[model samples]
Target: MSHHTVSVELENKPGALVRISQLFARRGYNIQSLAVGPTERPGISRLTLRVDCSEHTIEQIEKQMHKLVNVLRVVELLPDESVERELALITVGAPPDRRAELIALGDVFGARVADIGREALTFEIVGRPEELDAFEELVRPHGVRELARTGRIGLRRPGPRQSRAQAALT
Candidate 1:
């Protein structure tokens, strides 16, 4: 099954997340990644979910989400129409001799040194999911002490709109 990213708008209230999670469980759809946060509008939250399912199953899931009380909106984030990102904090063993090496590696991957301990260096990386994965692999040989990844969060891209004049020109 391929992966699909779904964006949901939920009411910012207690038990809202529970209801959604229960629905997924009941449907036997495993969530690969989920991120939830408040939106610009008060009393509303946005939930981004990554699930592995077929097109038919995803459609059914979306329909079920629409019937839920807390869910206000449900939309599949098509890759071409959305921008996605994930954040990772990786703590790798860094001996004094290897500190400069790791730092240079971080520079190539756009990661920053979040913390610099004598034996460990915590690097902060923010990028697309694949980019994060590549960084993780590159640093694994250094002996990772800990790693934390904030699952993907995404928003639809606002492409160029055709105003009246633009439409006329086109």
Candidate 2:
């Protein structure tokens, strides 16, 4: 199975998200990551979803999504031509003796110390999924007390901005 990232634009109305999830459920497709937020345009929301499935399955999902009333557009964010990111917050048990060492490691990963307590240190990191994984590994030995990751969100590289006349010609 191949991993695919799908971007969807839908009306920001009640039950719109539920209906989309229901479509995936009925088809037995598992959503790996999902992010939904308001776009620059009001009354609309952009959804970024990551799924592991074959090419044919993704095509079928998109077609079914098109049949739904709320969905406006759906597009795939190809890895080669898109930028993807995820954010993670990690709280690690830090003894007084180990605080300095942990902070140093976090600096190496471009993580900032979000919070510091006598016994725990909370770090915030934003990067590609793999980078987050590496940071986790680096802190695992120190005892991770809590962790949260905002799943993959992505956008395609800007190809070009077309003027109204250019769009009409195309």
Candidate 3:
């Protein structure tokens, strides 16, 4: 089995996420990571899903997804072609006598100290999955009390508009 990333553009409406998630669950495919957010268009949302499945299975899933009424478009985004993919991680911690050290370390990864409290400090970092992993590893000894992360989200760069001739061919 190999990992595949599929991006689905769907209408922004209630129960849409549920319906899409249920489609995957019923197929017994394990989703490694899923991220959904609003797109540039108003009333539209993009769903980025990373799943583990064989190539044949992925093709089958793609065909099946096309049958869904709410699904507007489904595109398989290749890593090299994708414009940007990012993950956000938020960590809260308090290292005794090591605040400056932690802050310095965070600075190296472009992480920001978002909040500070008597018992803990919250740091926010945005980067690729590997970067986030490295950041967490670096902060391990510094006393990371709690953490939350939004897994990878990606978008495909839009291509030039099709000419009238090309559109007619389709």
Candidate 4:
């Protein structure tokens, strides 16, 4: 199975998310990550979902999503044409002797130290999934106290011709 990312635009209603999730659940499709937020358009929200499934399964999932009520649009984000990011907050055991080293490692990944306590330091890192994975691996030996991640969010980069066409339309 290949990994797929899909962005869905839908009405901002109470049960919209539930219905969409149910569709996936009923189909036995596992969602690896999901992030939802309001869009610039009023009463509309965007959901970015990452799933591991076969190409045929993903096609079916998209078609099923289109049939759901309140769903405005569904688009598959091609990796080559998209920019993806995820946010992770990780707290690690930091003794005085290792504190500086931990800070330096975080610095290399452009991570910010969000909090520091007597025995721990929390870092906020925002980057692609692979970068976050590497950061986690490097810090695991220091004893991770806690970790939280905002699942992947992505946007497709429009081609130059598409950009020009959009500008002309506007």
Candidate 5:
């Protein structure tokens, strides 16, 4: 039941996302987080999916994704070898007297004050899932008004050997 992140490159066409989601639904796999966007290649899109499953299940899921018509490539992003990020927007109760304290707390987490209403302050935070969770926990006592979090997005980092080889070629 460990979390796994899978990155898929696919055709940027209508219903592509729906089809991928259906595949997971049919297999009874719940997606923990999913993010899809256009890639540098104009006609292709990259999808980052986070799911809780065993190693065997993830292998099967990758194989199934490869068989889909729209999917071009599928790869598992290992935590130690990949860079992952998530964005969250949180609005908390902020009275005039507590504004500075809230702002200081946000600064500790590298969050920005997106808005400062009279009774509420909105913060924009971008970081790993755990970082966002910690920020939320600390701000909960301030009375969270609303919160929205984007799915995790990840990119695999090149290994040392690959980097060395590429450098030599350059």
Candidate 6:
């Protein structure tokens, strides 16, 4: 029942997302959040996935994913490793009376007000999931009219850069 984040490298091609998502569905696993975008490498895209599953099930899924034609690699991100992660949150309709207080709380969590309107204010925060939870708890009583989040997007840290020689070999 633990939550896990996995990084999958795949070929940039049509129906790639559909194929991956369908694998999870067919296995009865729930994807908490998914982010897909191009990587530095040409013709390759990276998918950051947060899903809830057991280690055994995840291994099964990884093996299944490798069997697909487009899948290049699947690596589960471990917390102990050097990694970079970010998330953005938006809160609307913040009570005017608590504006200063909410703003201060956001400051404590390294968040900033992104937009302001007569009836609403949008705050954008980029950080780990735990940081987002703390920010949400601080602003909950201050009239959070709406909330939206982009779940963890990240990559390994301090890894050696691939030289042209190494890249060509791969």
For residue 93, model 6's alpha carbon misses the true position, in angstroms, by 2.8
lDDT per model vs. reference: 0.93, 0.91, 0.79, 0.93, 0.92, 0.79
Estimate, for each residue in 23-76, the C-alpha lDDT of model 3 and write its tens digit. 888987778888899999999999988888998888877887888888899887
TM-score for candidate 5: 0.92
User: Between 2 and 5, whose TM-score is larger?
Assistant: 5
Candidate 3 residue pairs in clash (backbone atoms < 3 Å)? none
lDDT for position 135 in model 4: 100
**Candidate 1 accuracy as TM-score:** 0.93
Error of 2 at 83 (Å): 0.8
TM-scores for every predicted model: 0.93, 0.90, 0.84, 0.93, 0.92, 0.87
Clashing pairs in 1: none
Model 5 per-residue lDDT tens digits across residues 1-170: 79999999999989999999999999988899899988889999999999999988999999999999999999998776677889999999999999999999999999999999999999999998889999999999999999999888888776633455544432
Cα deviation of 169, candidate 5, in Å: 26
* Backbone atom clashes (below 3 Å) for every candidate: 0, 0, 0, 0, 0, 0
RMSD of 3: 7.0
RMSD score of candidate 1 (Å): 4.9
lDDT per residue (tens digit) for residues 48-75 in model 2: 9999999999999899999889999999
Model 3, C-alpha of 43: deviation from truth (Å): 1.4
Which 10 consecutive residues of model 3 have the lowest summed lDDT?
161-170
Model 4: lDDT of residue 50? 98
User: RMSD for each model, in Å, please?
Assistant: 4.9, 6.2, 7.0, 4.7, 4.3, 6.5
Candidate 6 on 39-136: residue-level lDDT in tens?
99999999988888899988887889899899999988765443535666566566577677767877887798998876678789987777787777
